[model samples]
Target: MDADVTDSAGTPADPDHRAGDTPQGRSQEEPGATDSTDGSEPVPQKDAPQDETPQGEATDADAPQGSGDEDKAESSDENKADREADGTGAQTWADHPKDGSASRRKRPWLRWAALGASFLVMISAGAGWWLYKKLDGNITTDTSAAAELKVYEKERPTPVVMDAQNILLIGSDSRSGDNRKYGRDDGGSQRSDTTILLHLAADRKSATAVSLPRDLMVEVPKCRTGDDKETREQFTQFNSAFELGGTACTIRTVERLTGIRIDHHMVVDFNGFKDMVDAVDGVEICLKEPIDDKDARLELPAGRQTLNGEEALGYVRARKTLGDGSDTERMERQQRFLGALVNKMQSNGVLLNPTRLYPVLDAATKSLTTDSGLDSLRDLYDLVRSMRDVPTDQVQFLTVPRQPYRQNVNRDELVQPDASELFKQLREDKPVAVVPADELKEKEKAQDEKPDDTGSDSESPTPTPTYSGSSAADDLCEQ
Candidate 1:
């Protein structure tokens, strides 16, 4: 008996294992092995059953285990190729590091914020343009004035210096249309209730407002009416030119009187004046006595008080009830009221607030009938901008010196040398000698108290010529 031979699994092994024979008792053969001297033919042994399944009849469980790993690797390679083809292989937001994600998240929000800001800017710009157009349209232009002025353009005086400006401001008392409620409405004749020649210095440091009395006797030149009717030239009241013609004739008369070129003119009617006063809320005025005037429709008690539009108009117009009843005294009152008004407008925060400013502008533009040069919004804006920085104290108001006419006490005549001197100074763009009323009083007091220095005949400093008027900085209500 051979030693009991067994396989590793304890199964019975082949009996001819040492003989190198097949299980069927045939000789075993190997590749390249030499055969023994016994003449037996070599035979091949049968292979063990393979684990593979038949073709086209295999299940997932029957597939080799390594095949599953190969399938998984192939799928991963295909996914990588798709990512690279889509150009998102390493740049996908989700795959980014923590810091990159934070920055990436902010990008969209920043873009949206910028877009929102741009939209707001566009809206604001559109609103501003609309507002400008609306304000611009409110102004009324007098084409007739331009046409009339052109006829006399050659006769008008030339400017003495550059950058000097003269503007004729006419307050028209037209009892027509809305103004009919204020005064007599005879046909449509309008007269200049107030005339002011505003001279702006070439250096822009000083401003002078010279008020012309309506009762001043002056030579009225030939002028054509609105209907092409021509009036013969005659000596008449200064404001009679406006009654005969309109703004053009009035400008011509002023030009002839002062020999100063009028660069522009503005005519404001009664109703418009009231609206302006109302827009600024009211102007403060002081009254020495109680006033109850039926002609002017003003009723107010004594003391400092704020006057409404109607009251203000009445206050300015009430001559007999408020003062010595002379037109001169009335003019002085008008100057004081205007000075207070200027002070109020400059110091009361009106220009700084849009809400307050718009109404004032609206009332002012609508109230004005301007010459062609200053008809447009841009022209008016430029004019106002140029003078916005002028100091209130430098804004001086004075009447052209006048006295009772030789023939009539009601009429006025310009004082000879003083009036000519004032006109020459204005025409030459020279500074007017104007000292504040209080300062002049103080100087007079000092002169009374001090002794004259007669021993040393030293030349005195040229005194700044003083005029009788009030500055815008002066307080009208002060005792």
Candidate 2:
């Protein structure tokens, strides 16, 4: 059976004007209004007496096809609707079923869901922006050092390589504020406990860190102090430059020695170092002998052990208890430990994983005081990201060649040509090689153990020259 078409909510279908309506039914309509049903002509009330005409008497030409009685029934309904509209207000789309249904079918939940999704996106975006701002703000700008550098801008060395970069990393031993727990607070006075000249190759395939000994004597330039007073230049210990005139003074001293432009610098305090170590959980190292240093606040056993921030700091800084009790040994330990730290970060997926990376970034940013070039989070992130792909074997750590000074065996001076060659290679952005300390030791031992070849004229193959240093990929366990 054919079903009757219906409106929304199962309501019977209806048109604007029924085919059975009479002239009187439209009598209550306003004047000059045209009949809207099927685009018919207007029904003018020219015959007022038609209202009283026989109810069932319909002119075939005037009426549409339908029974007279049915027309009378529909006409009655129309008359009632017209009368009600005249008494009350006209219907709006919300009240009229047909008009309201034509406007739209409402699905309120879908609307709420759209609004909810929009709100959630806004909240997430806000949180991300806030986090970026916080991290960006954490970096402290070395404006004072920058200002000091500007004063000697002309005196500074020009850059040799366009894309290559050299950053002066100074580990400040300042014992002020929270750092006092590590040592005495000498009224904010401090020295450069450790300094490394970090170079990044133009191709981004390698990085080399050269540690400068604190006892190495060099010519210190006349630099302006915090009080804006300049002191006379003199030949003195390298570390004294920091104690005398801060970062700018140290930079000047290093420039005079290396003749390489210092593009940017970072000064990290003792607390910062500790926090960074802790952020990466801990760095693992192999200890040959037991250590118990009261001054460094470190105590450990011989074996493979992971050292936390506090223990790691002490392990790197303890001079008298480790190796030959010399600053050279201390610097070597520091470099090797740093290499282990870098290897851990790469191997443990710290750089690739965001959850792990944030803590490390927080620790580093909080502790770093950098120049204007690298004082923002974006700059630092870009710098780190560029080096993330560098292979561990290419990341080398070594010290500038040095030997005991003739004037004092306790002091040191550059090893002349070896030091100059290294500097020249770096300044020209050329590749340099490094050998692991333990591997070098084993080779030396093997050479000593071999029998004397007095009867043989065997000539050894020429070997490529390499520095006595360690890479991040060096394994102490293999020693």
lDDT of 2 by residue, 332-432 (tens): 88988888888989999998897898888888989899999999989998899999999999999999999888899899899988898888889989888
Query: Each model's TM-score, in the order given?
Result: 0.75, 0.75
Go through the candidates in order and give each one's C-alpha lDDT: 0.78, 0.82
Poorest lDDT segment (10 consecutive residues) of candidate 1 = 1-10
Over 1-479, each residue of candidate 1 has an lDDT whose tens digit, in order, gives: 01111111133336756664333211123321223436655333233234432223334575456645564454344445555666443222233245443355658888899999999999999998888888788889999988988888898888888898999999988888888888789997888999999999988888899999999999989999988999999999999999889989999999999999999898887777778789899998777889999999988999989998899889888886876898887877788888777778778877667777777778888878898888877898788767767888888989998999999988999998889889998999887756655776787789899997889778887565567787788787872
For candidate 2, list the clashing residue pairs, or say none: none
Q: Candidate 1: TM-score?
A: 0.75
Error of 1 at 212 (Å): 0.4
Query: Residue 368 CA error for candidate 1 (Å)?
Result: 0.6
Q: What is the lDDT of candidate 2?
A: 0.82
Runs of candidate 2 with Cα error greater than 4 angstroms are 1-108, 437-465
